[model samples]
Target: MIEQTLLKCEEMIQRGSSSFYKAFAGLPSPRREAVHVIYAFCRMIDDSVDEPEESPYSIFELRSHFQNLDHAEGHFIWPALRWLFENFPQSSKDQFMLQMQGQVRDLSFTHYETMDQLESYCYLVAGTVGEMLLPVLRDDSNEEAQSAGIALGMGMQIVNIIRDVGEDLTRGRRYLPLEVMEKHGYTQQELERNVVNDRFIAVLQELKGAALDWFKEGLDNVHTYPPESGMAVELAAAFYAGILDDVAASGYDVFRRRAYVSDEAKLLMFRRTAARYPSPFGGKGAAAVH
Candidate 1:
């Protein structure tokens, strides 16, 4: 029964986010299964708000069940959560609950006016993910390591905002800060019109630069992770960062097309990563130390 429950979680992750699944698949045993569970719950929480009609549980229901997980019933996720908590007692329930709180923001926030607002939203939605994964992926969840993890999540969230601008507009949501847009001379009207002009490019570049900066801060503590895990984190960051490159290659048409790194490119990236981390771990540098 436990095996079946974990398998359901695995399927949820494999179906929902292949990139995430691929990056962490190398983990051994319960750790790998744990990642699957975390992703599945987070995905469900996100879908509950983002696609309420289709989600299995309302956001409120999810929180209730998660808060009372030991006796919670009625879904593979509940059993999976029970197993996760049983196996990893150190896991932070607070981080998981905070994630639910973050999803609730989508219910009311339709537009953002300041970088502070955007950052707070990003932290709630994505930074918490890093904190959630820290204990599962690394030996130490110290303040510095956890902070770096949040930075990585924030960077990835910025990339998501840049890539999903068009899709977001369809939902009447604009994550880009009004101040940044104004500074770049790109008006909200221009964004709504899908005008891919110089100012638009500037706005994207500004966000892209910010994303890269956070990525650097995020990776600053990579060596603190287990070798294979460090490699996986690095790879996920590389793939996300690649989206910006593809956007540039597409002449910045984020409005009409979603940019992606090809499977072939992923293979090449995997090879480079494998070379760095090696089979028995320990390569060098900030990624695979000693």
Candidate 2:
């Protein structure tokens, strides 16, 4: 039963995030299945907050279900998550709680006033995923690897915020720090009006610069993981950072259209990473990674 559930989880990831699915494919057996379970659980929680009809009640239910794991026997996500927590107790518990905290924060429809506040939100929402995945990606529980993972997740989340500025406005949320916007002479009113002017572009450039620095920090420690895992992390980081590149190529007009990295670009990135490393994991097609 758990096996079937995990298979469905894999399908969910493949459909929702091809980049992550591709990265996970590089992992060996049971570990890959484990990661799928993690992704599925996170995806479920994220949807609870982001989807139009979903409500805070779903998050409350999740909290209740997590607290009473044994009573959650029949639940699809709980069983898998229970297995994950049991297997990776240290990494799973706190990180999962932090993720839930971030989701709860999303329900209030607030704007971040400062960069620190935004970073805190990012750490809870995305950095925690990195910490949770660290145990699965490597045997050693070192601080450097965990830090790098968090940085990687932060970089990706920042890029997501940059790309989704217009979409987020429609949802009555703004992830960008207002302090930074004010510093760049960009106003909330202008943003709401979908103004893509010099000031807005400047704000984006500053945000992108910070994101790129985080990516560099993450990539620097990518080699800390075992070869295959390191490659996977590297590929994932590159693919996400590629979106920022696409945004730049589009002249940072995030309000005009959403930025995305194509599948062909992803495949090319995988091949490039494989070629650069020259490992047994290299030269295989996307399907081969699975």
* Candidate that scores best on lDDT: 1
lDDT of 2 by residue, 118-167 (tens): 98998999999988899888878878888898999899899989999988
lDDT of 1 by residue, 111-220 (tens): 99998999999999899998888888876668999999899999989999999999999988999899989998999889889999999999889999999999999999
Clash tally for model 2: 0
Give the Cα-based TM-score of candidate 2 against the true structure: 0.94
**CA shift of 17, model 1, Å:** 1.2
How well does each candidate superpose onto the true structure, as a TM-score?
0.94, 0.94
State model 1's lDDT: 0.86
Worst window of 10 by summed lDDT in candidate 1:
281-290
After TM-score superposition, what is the CA distance of residue 283 in candidate 1 from its true location, in Å? 14
Clashes of 1: 0
